[model samples]
Structure formats: C-alpha cells, structure tokens
Target: MTLETEFRTRAFEDVRRALLERREIALLDVREEDPHARSHPLFAANLPLSKLELEVPLRLPRRSVPIVVLDDGEGLAQRAALRFTELGYTDVALLAGGVRGWAAAGGELFQDVNAPSKAFGELVESERHTPALDAQEVQALLASDANMVVFDARRFDEYQTMNIPGSISVPGAELVLRAQQLAPDPTTHIIVNCAGRTRSIIGTQSLINAGVPNPVTALRNGTIGWTLAGLELAHGSTRRFSPATDGAVRVAAAAAARAVADRAEVGRTTRDEARRWADEAVRTIYRFDVRTPHEYESSHVPGFRSAPGGQLVQETDMFAPVRGARVILADSDGVRANMTASWLAQMNVEVYVIDGLTPADFTEEGVAPPARNAVTPPASDEISPAELSALLQSPGTVVLDFTASANYVKQHIPGAWWTLRAQLADALPKLPPAQRYVVTCWTSALARFAAPELAELTGKPVQVLTGGTSAWLAAGLPLETGETQLASPRIDRYRRPYEGTDNAREAMNAYLEWEYGLVAQLSRDGTHGFHVI
Candidate 1:
C-alpha cells in the first residue's frame, strides 16, 4: 500500500508548539520497555513496535488523534509512520530525533512510571525550595524543639530493618495514597528519608505534587548521610505490631516465605537465637537486612547484609542456596519484614525477622531463643562464600550487581559488574556455564536470594557476599566508586560498534526498543507484581 500520510522530517517546532498550546499530541515512544523504564520523555505514552496494533487502538481512542513515533537511534520511526498511516492514522508523524532529540532539548526524562529521575531532579532543585535537615540536623531540630514528623520513604522492608531512629516507611509511590495514614494534624512539619537521595526526593516531592498542606523536606542524602555523620541506627529485636493485629498472621506470612526458601516448617529467630546461627561456621547463615539499597549501603547489621525486599522475593534461591538452610531477616519496619517473611514461608523455607536489636543488643544477648521446630535438614549442598571466592580467583568469574543503576554507579564492591535487576533473569543465559558466577549487591539480602538462584539456574558455583559490600569495606578491602557507569548499548552506544553483520545496527536498535518496553511486556508475564526497589 502506498503511504497516504506525508512524513514531517522537521517536526520539532510542531511538537514544541503542540506542547505549549496544550494541543493533544500523543508523543508515542516506539522504544521497548527496558530502556523506557530506564528513561523516557516525560509526557510520552509508550507505543512499542510489537504492540503498535494493540496499544494504538486502546490509547488513541479518537481515530484522527495526532501521534508521534520514536525509536532508539533507528529509522524504525519511518516504518512505524507508514504502519500508522496504513492503519488509518492520518495525523501520525515521526518525532524528529525521536527520544534523543527530546533529551537533547533538555526535556526531563522519567525512569519508570514512578520516575526516580524526575523525583531526583526535583529533589536536587528542592534543596533551595524546602528546609531540609540531615540526621544530625534533625536531631538538633528535635533538641531545639522543632516539631517534625519523620517519614521513611523506603520500602517497608528497609524501614523495619533499620531506619533513621523514628522514621516510618511511607514510600514515594505510596505517598499520595498513604499521606493521610500519617499526620492527624496537617500542620506538622514533615521530613522524609530513604536509604539515600532518590526515594526521599521523590517521596517528599510527591507530597508537594499532590498539594498536601504540609511543609515537607527530605533528609539530606538520606540515611547514608545520616550514618556518615556518626548517628545511631536502630533495629527492633521483636517486631512491634498493632495489638489488634494477630501474631498468627505474621507466622502465616513467614510460613509463605519459608515455602519460597523450599522449607516445610519455618521457625522464628531472636537476637540471641540468630547469633547462634551466625556463630556456626559450618552453617553459613547469611543475614540480610531486607531494606532499600541506600539504607543497606549506609549502615546495616554488623554481620547482616542488604537484600532488597522485592528482589529477595523474586530471586530467593540465588541468595540462600543451602536450598532449605536457615535464612534470617531483619528490618527496621515490622510490615516489610513480615511481608517478606510471609513470602519466604510460602516458599517453604526457614526464615525469621530480628526485632528491636542494635549491634549492642546482639552483643548483650547471647545466641538462644525458645525452642519451636526441630526439622533442621542435613547439610545443604550449597557452596559457601569462601568456596565461591576461591572460584572467583580463577578465570572467568562473572559478578553481577543487581541493584539500581545510580547506586551501582556510585559505589559497589571491587570487581563486581553492573546488571539491571529487570534484565538479571535474561542476562544469566549469556554467561558461559563454565565460569564461576557471583551475584552480589550492596548488602546480603539481594545476594542472599539472588546468588543461590544464579547457582541453581546457571549451575555455576554462585556465591553471595556473606556480609555484602559493607563487610568488604570493614575488612579493609578496596571498593570501586566513580561516575563511570557500566557501559550498555542503552547507556553508551559508541562503545558497541556496528560491524556490517546481518544488520547488526538494526538488530541492536530493535533489541533496545524491546528493552525499553520490557517492564510493560513483563506485565504480560502474568507475574501479578512489579519491581519494588
């Protein structure tokens, strides 16, 4: 069929005008989900190439609606324009320079639908807009009788593991929905924090975006900054839940998480109880403070490692490989620890949450807890961290850090490579099975879950960082910190040259387009979940 709609090669001016004039222009991103989740134009509605026929009809309810198409540095836009034209879209046009041009024009790009880049940008911009306090500053403010309501804008898991003393988990995405859950008085001064900067910025601004009638500010650089400033971090020894809420519910949830761990009967661990497991050299019990990366990076349990909540759920086997070995969880917040514990229980694995215990508390209380279940199985076939490390010293040991790109860029353990969590399951097959694989993160929680799974999936001796990166630093091991982000086709295209092999450029472009739209495609995976941190 001949193309009916003429292509507008110089449509930048038109797009700028349409945006300013409030004219409805469907700025369609033809890029796939992964890259789109990584970053995208602020106002763009993603219309991926594969889903063009399906999404176009749903998004563009009006037949004659103006739409623009984009692909990552490819000529797919022209093909898409022809397709749209063939599909009866008269006003369809290709965006000049596509998303690249929008970015070049200094338009804000969003990361995920709950955009962290926008939130981080607004937060950087907000330093001048709001009155922020660091952990020390907040302490001083409290000492000076400043009435501030502290909200932890991390996942409930991180909050329960260790938060800024009094902070509560009111995550950024839930800020708009759960604002009223806090603040009986709207006039109270509000301060928010996550492990580091991103979520706090977004969470604090979410309040402002929703026009909440409270003076909100983020803890400067969040809890990492809080710890670097020589502040005290709190952990609960026993979870404090609402008296009205049944403890059995938590037990039921813990049972679920144990199931994830592949255990039949689950048991609880007290501070002393957990220490007994920690003391056993043969056992190799990995303690994960299932909190956000920022929080885990800042300060966590001395022996405990960071394992983000959602990722822990998805990749439980990787982190805790003693298939049915004991895995203990600690969170500063009750809800997240309980929630993750529940998932672990469902996995049929042994799990427990550390409640109200600081490092001092652990030292004060010896290892012991009231007896419960005695179904401790035989020694797991799981390889220890020391074994994995020995393997790494050999040739081809691929260490993947499945954490946020920004966090991965900031500081990671020495010799670890960056891999996005969304792409972790997909990236596994690419590595040669002969190579030893070590999947790690800032802390043990993610590694605790991911490492074992990697071992299981790749059948390579996969080991988690026993105490995560913090342990590495404490042991005086070197760390790699820099602005140098891991090179990917999506991040650094110049590094990957196009050899004229079977349309390499076209294939790469198509792959990136698909990557940009990956999360949306994952929704089609029927997983009934989204990435939580």
Candidate 2:
C-alpha cells in the first residue's frame, strides 16, 4: 500500500465528534507557525514539522495518545504521520484533506496562536462577569492619580515594547503573589492589562480568584483597546515588580497563595511522586521549574525545564501541547507552583506542585535532557566562516539561512535564501540547481540538524556554517538586509497585529473583532473542555 493508505485518515467531523465527546486526542496542525496562524481549527495545536522530533517527546510523551496531524494540502500531513510512526507513536493518523477539509466541513478557522485559551478567557469574562474598565475610564484614573496602580500582565519584553504610562510589569501568574507588594493598601484599586484581552482578563480574575483585598479590574481589551481609543502608550518602560524585602510580606503572600491553591483543590506531589509519574509508560508527564528564567538558569532540579509560572499559564498550549498530559511544577518557595497549579487545575490540566523540596534539592542541578532524536553534526560537514566566504565567491554554491524570519530580515549573508527548515523538502526542488549547499541559522544548531537531512535529500555534499550568521558577523563579513533570494515563502513566523506600533489600525480592529467572535466559535467547535471555576 502507498504511504497515504498506510496511515488512517480522520475526517473533520470525526475529529469534531471526538472533541465534543471529550475523548483523549491531539489535533495537531503540522505546518509552520505563520500559515497555522493564518487559519486553523479552534483546538488545533501548531506543531511545526521542523521541530516535531524535538517537541513531541516533551509535549506528547504518551506514545499511544491518538494524534491527528494536519496541513494545508501541502503533503505535510502524511510526511508528519510517517515521522510520528518512526518515533514509535502507535496511534497516529492524518487529518484528511488537511485544514481545507476542516473548512469544507463547515468548521470555523481561527487566526492566532492559543485560540482556545484566549477564547476561553472571553468565555470566563462572559460567564463570571469579570470586572473591567475601558480605555477612557483607565485614562481618567491615571490622570486623577487616585489610589490605583496599573499592572501590565504580559512578558517583560512585551511590557518594554509598549505599555500604559505608569504600569509595572507583573505578568499573569505573578499578579496574586506580588499584588500585595505593589499595592499594600487593602482599598487600593488595581488595574491589570495585557496586549490584548486574554492576559488582562485572566490576570484580573487570578487576583479575584485568590481573594486579594484590593478591588481589581482588567483594562478593557488591554493596550489594543487603549490604542484604539487614541490614548498614548509608553515605550521602552523598564519598570518591574520590586523584590519583597520584608520577611512578613513574603510569609503573608505565601500563606495567601497557598490558601487559594487549597481552596481550588490543587494537588501536591513530591519529587519521588513526580519521578514515578515520569516513569509511567502509559502517561505523559511534564516537569517544570516555575521560577524566573534567571533563577532557573542559575540552578534548578535536574531534568526539569524552566517555565516561568506566569508564561506557562498564559501559553499553556505551547508549553504543554498535549491536552491530557500531567504537569508537575516546581518552585523553591512553593507558593508560585501552588498558585500556578491552581489555575492549571481550573483549566482542566492534571497539575501538581512539588512540595517540601529544599533549596539543596534545586541546587543539585543539570541542564534539561536533549530531545530523544536530537541531531549531532559531523565535524566533517561543517565549514568555517572563512571557508564559507571563499565558497560563496565560487560558483555553484547555494546558501540557505534557516534563522527566524525576523532575524533573517534584519541581516544575513548577501545571497543566502531565507528558508523554513520544516519546508526543506518542498523548497529543495524549487531552488536553482547547485553543486553544493551550505546551511546557516542564528546559531548553527538548527543548521547542523538540517545539514544531514539536506545531504540525504539532494545526494549532494552539504556543509553547515560553523557558527552560523553570528560567526559571519564576528568575521567582519559584509551583511545584507531585506529578503534576498527566497527558496520558500516566509511562512515560518506569524506577525501579530496587536504587537508593535507598525500594525495598521484596521488590522487591530479586525483582531479585536476576531477575539469578540471567539465565544460563538467555541460553541460551534464544541471540542474545548474548558470549565470556569
């Protein structure tokens, strides 16, 4: 039988039924982020074909979990299915006819990452009557200098990019733990905001859920709404949460956070219990250190990856792609993990906090284990910057840059084609015939991974740029800007309309409208097992 016949194919309706029935399934969109963002089913997780092997074991460790791979009629689904089988996944199938088939079956296609979670955030606002204040009201509050503080509940980088005039960066999961420090007065009015509605609503509700003394409200629709109202936003703001210097404050915050977790019925697990969960062959378990990146990098539990508690909850789908997997969160202080686990428990994740672990347990550290199928480049197949420069001067040498789209646009080797590593198979045949190929990325890590694949596919000697584009710059090589030669369309990264100041007002308005319509779409999709507690 052919490859298509070798794998079972599920229709969109079958997937829909599986979702509504709450069956254990992962409907993965196996395309790059850009195209996946342009359109996809509500619950479809974006698992780019390029990062499949690296992400699969961490995200979907249960080999027998029923997985349906999808693509946009690009023959990616079948290829991904084959890869899944090769990775020892026993129950992999293709989403028949890909995303096009889903649309044809009258399914709604969302246009962003983490659509389900965002949509669920909207539902929570609708159901729980989450309090919020629009731009004009918030702007007035800012002007009056009332007893209030604005907390931007987004990543620090995003907060730095743009924020309300006086807002301090307090990301989602940190809102409860740090709120008292930012606003100690019980009667103080607290305003939470994100780039858009999801984080703001979730952050505001997180405070309310924890029963903070302050009266909290989300800045309606976040910065998007603020911008649309013609309000000015400050850029390059460096304001962040101050450390709690007082022992009483830390003790009180921990007690309050733990109380919230207990009320939510969040489970607690020991390191031994976590290890047992990881050893289970039938279930997928994720171990994460829920602390700041700096703390995590300084020292952390061996085999545990760093995922700040706030971002983990905000982007849970990205962190834990598999729907039914068990997540074990670790934090040295214990409060952050418990608070984060409380939210995850409400979001229908089987979550636990690693309790009673000492500082030494965390200090006995190591880096995260490499992916099961991580590639090691052969030194024979690598070329130094000087060697690549000389080769570029010669004819019949083609360079393909596999860096992020944004980075590729910033600077690259003059004649290098910006290519998506995942689309190499489709892109190779379209490239001009060349005797040799040299692959490079921001660093040579991804380049090394792709070199062997390119060599096997083209039956040509492929060499990796020793240190990638960074090394080229270090060697004082002339760089070029803008897309030069392109072997593939730049569909590897999605440009967020809500991000940065360059987006059109129309796009921002449309993005808001899309978010507003998500609740209705969720009703139609009927697969998301979201329950607001």
Candidate 3:
C-alpha cells in the first residue's frame, strides 16, 4: 500500500475498544496546551507538534507502537503524522474528525490536563474509601497537643509556595522511604496533604498498603479545604523530611515496601532481563530511574531517564503514552522503586522494580539530553547575549519571547513581547511591524525552531538569542516582569482553581465538586483499565 493509503483515520469507537482491552496505544493531541485543555478524550496525551522531536522518543519508546494523532481541525494531525513518519514511527494514524470527531462518535471529552490520572485518583478514593479527616477535626487536633504531624505530599517547590501552617515537606514516594526517620514512634498520628486531594490520598493509602504501624489519615480536600475553613497558610516554609540514617530503619522500611509491592503483583527483574527487554524490537520498554532529580543526575544506570517516582505515578500518562507498554523502574534504595511500582500495578500497568541494585551500579553521570530525531545547529543569524542587548535599543528591532507565559511573567528581557510558537501565524498580525526579529525561549532550543518559522512568516531577518533568556540572566542584563506586552495570547497553561491564594471561594468549591464526581464520570466513560489493589 502507498504511504497515503497506510495513514488511515482511526475511529473513536475502535480506540475505545483498544483502551478497554488494555492494549498498547498512544492517543496524542498534537496541539498547544491551552487549546488541548479545552477538550480531548480521556486517554489523549498532549504532545504539541512544536516539541514532537524533543519529547517523543523517550515518551513513545518503540517506534511500532500504534499511535493515533488528533487535532481540532487545524490540520496539525496530518502534519504531525507525517513528522512521525519522518521520525521512523512505523504505525501512525489520524483520529477521524479530530476532537469534534470523537464527540460525534459519542466519546466523552474531558477538560484540564492530567485528566486520566486525576480520574483514576478519584476512582481509587471512592472504592477504597480512604480514611480522611475534615478540616475542622484537623484544626482541633492541631490546637491540642495530639502528637500528630502533617506531611505535605507535593514537590518541595510547591510546598515552598504555600502549605498548611505546620506541615513538613515529604513528597509522595518519599513518604514510604522516609517514614522510619519522620515517624519512628508507631503511635504517632500522621496526616498527609497536597495542593488538592490526589497526592494526599495516594500518599496515605501508600502507607496503609505498606502496613505501617502508624494511625494515618488524608487531610480531606487537602490545602483547598484548609483555605475554605478560614485558616491561614504558611509561605516560604523550608521544613523537609531528612534522609534515613539508621540502617535498621532503612532495612525495615525497604522490607515493608517490598511486601506491599509483592501483594500488588509487581514483578521484579534483573539488569540482564532489563537489557534484553530494551533490545526487543516489537515491545516498548520505558527504562526510568525513579529517584530524586539530584540523585539521578549524580549517578544512575545508563539508558535510564530520570523520572522521580511520585511525579511518575501521578503523571504516568505523560511519561508513558502507550497504555500497556512495559515500564521498568530503577532506584538504588529499595523503598522508592518498590513503592512506586505498586501504584502502577494497581493502575493496571505492567510495572517492575529493579532487583538487587547498589551504589556501584550507578555508572552514568549528569542529566541525559532528551532523545531527538532531529537537531538543527545554530545557523548564520545567531546573536550573542551582548549583541541582543545592543540590538534591543535600536528602533528596527523587536524581540519575541517564546517561553511559557509563567516564565515570561517571572523574568524576561525588557521590551520582549511574550509569544507562543504554535500561535505565531495568528500572532504575527498582532505584532508591530519591524525590520528585524530576534526569537528566544528558556534555552534557545525552542527558539531555534521558532526562528525559521518567524523569518518565513514575516519575510524579515530573524536572529536567535544565542542561549535564550537564560543566557541574558547570566550576563547580568536588565529584565522586566509581569504579564505585559503579549504579542500572542497566554494560552500555554490552564490555571487551576486550587493553585495560588487568590482564587474565588466558589471556584475552589466547584473544583472539589468536579473531582468528587470523577468516579461517576469514569463509570460513564468506561475505558479506564483501573482497579483497587
């Protein structure tokens, strides 16, 4: 068959059947974040076409995994499928009728990012009826000397942003690994919390699953509930769980985690077995070192990409788009990988924890560059940071910042208009006419991709900032802040109602109610291959 005939459109019903059968398939939304968040299928992963090469190889692994690319009639799916073909992806198809097509075929469309995992978390909570304490009870406990400790099961940076007054930073996977150090006294009362309910529920359930001897409970609705109760939150708190120093405690924790993993039917595999799996041409295997970023960058087994265990569990759909692909998790400490694998297994993933790992086995050093099918070198029209600074003062020059709107709000070169790479076609008409254009992003990696497009769109000379906005900061150059001067709409991220302190009370409650109904939604949708362990 000709290439045109081979690139067929997959029906939404057929895709649903694959999901129900627990077969390997990747449903990708080839659009920017904002547009994708507006509508998509339950299992569709947003893999923006602009960053396809930069992210796809690690995410999709085996080239032969069946992939259905979808778009909202922007003609992006056809272009993305062709790009996938160029990247040597053997089986690529387009979703017929795009987002509208799915709806036309009676497929349920979900709003927001990470919808599948969020829905799964809701399902887990509903089935298990995970024990939890409401805000009032938690407040009363805090008022008294109840011997209770609240652990924030979110990233440290998020904890730093805002948290319950006395909660300590102990992110999800670390809860099991650091339990011995944080709460050696079995009688101590433990409360797990997150920005919302999901991580906290998972963290509390993780402890319960491991058979920890403590009385544990999730803080109902997490910090959102706390905020709704007229309680104050502490900002810039640095309290964190220290590493386990006692060998006895570490050994005990590891043993507990292993037994829990065993109960969940998570397999164990040796290095030789892992290597053999990686070499298989037909099966997709995702090798991930599920440890802290610092630990993975310092040392890890080669060929394993860094994916912190907690985030990996919460963002599995993002990391491994193929539903039934084999996932191999490695970490020197037995607690992290095992605990993480148990959750994946319960989520109907084929997961395994590396067996018999040691410090000596971590031979690789530093972060691995993302796997890319193509890389265009810095072309003739690149300018140094100093050169960009000089050019910014000239009348004919206009700088377009192609980074995320959040980053642009945080810090960006003065006079650089916040721009979106994917929206450049629409944005060009909005931007002021100029004789020269300089494009930039975080590392100029994305900026290089934008440079050629911007040049072609405007038919103007476009120079890329040698190393993007980061290099400008390093040079001690002057910068500005806030959401000013946008050439493109800031549709890169959907702001969550639970985030930040300024959300309206009604919005927060609405978000909670939405989460509460996810289990019912899951039942109606009927494609999630999830079960309680």
TM-score leader: 3
TM-score result, candidate 3: 0.95
* lDDT score for residue 302 of model 2: 75
- How do the residues 331-431 of candidate 1 rate in per-residue lDDT, one tens digit apiece? 64344454555445544445777766664442212222221221221222343455555666677876676554556667876567665432345565554
lDDT of 2 by residue, 288-335 (tens): 888777778778987688898878877788888777677899987756
Which rank order by TM-score, best down to worst?
3, 2, 1
RMSD of each: 19.4, 2.6, 2.3
Tell me how candidate 2 scores on lDDT: 0.83
lDDT of 3 by residue, 1-533 (tens): 32354478899989999888878899999898878987899889999887776678778878889999999998788878987887788889999999999999988888777888788888888888899998889999999979889999888998999999889999898898887678879999999999888898999999998888999999999989998998888999999987545788778888999998999899999887898898875778898998888888899998798888888888888888888789999988798899999999988899998898778889999997656434444464899999988877778899999888999999999989888777788888877779999988888888887888788888999998888999999999999999888987777777777665365688789888878888887888888878888
lDDT of 3 at 57: 71
Count of clashing pairs, candidate 3 = 0
- Which has the higher TM-score value, candidate number 1 or candidate number 2? 2
TM-score of each: 0.36, 0.92, 0.95
Give the Å error, residue 500, model 2. Answer: 5.4
Best by lDDT: 3
lDDT of 3 at 499: 65
Off by over 4 Å in 3: 1-7, 372-380, 501-503
Candidate 2: pairs in clash: none
